[model samples]
Target: TIPACNANYLPEGISEHCPIKVTFVEEGLNTNKLFQFCNVWAKHPLFIDKVQAAWVKLLMVLLKKELKVLNTQFFRNVVAEANDDRMALYLAQNKLQADPMNMTLQRRREGEILEVQKYIIYGRDVLTT
Candidate 1:
């Protein structure tokens, strides 16, 4: 059966930060269950807020330590991909330069150049006027 929340009047400043209680009722079986899974209360409106708060707190604590636990492999992969892309662009440029009359090589070189540029600017948060 679908779980639902009953609107309970809460005191000011209490309900604002509190997660809504979700109750699941099984009809005919007369069984009731609180919706909680994976360390999160599914019925609460502030579930995501709580999780994000905990995450930020954990990140802050981690930042105080010397261990680089997060984004290490991700950054490494990005660097590796950038290096490979640069090498490919270099080879394409050389091939195009050597055979200037070849339209295919020229197109390939242009595509490689654009790809490299796109990769470099992939996640940059740039604001335009």
Candidate 2:
């Protein structure tokens, strides 16, 4: 979307309308290229302004279109499930500390600690070693 430094209209060959040729120069390099873009892009809210401001700094879109899907997956897989394991591990550690002989609390602590460790290994936002 760089600004065109030169423009010319060529004589119509087969079509009724003349073809517009635009030239762009960047840092001493010159180019004459034809750009083909999707019509849907023209419908964007900032279409006109984005084109005009391209010379200032070219910036574009990201995952803004489907953020809702990502939010659900991230919360369910990384945040909510990891928090559940953390809470269970915490309870198991406290109960085991009170009655060190209890086999049930010992087993629970082992299982929950493994689950929390899996989250840690996967690089999730959980308490680290």
Give the residue spans of candidate 1 off by over 4 A.
1-72, 123-129
Question: Which candidate gets the maximum lDDT versus the true structure?
Answer: 2
What overall lDDT goes with each candidate model?
A: 0.59, 0.66
Candidate 2 residues 1-105, lDDT tens each?
Answer: 666477776533222355688786555656768998999999999999888888445333344335536756665535566767777776777687689899998
Give me the runs in candidate 2 sitting further than 4 Å from their true place: 1-69, 74-77, 127-129
True-structure Cα RMSD, model 2: 24.5
lDDT of 1 by residue, 12-104 (tens): 111124334445554456567886666447568998898899999999887945333343544554545655666676687667657879999
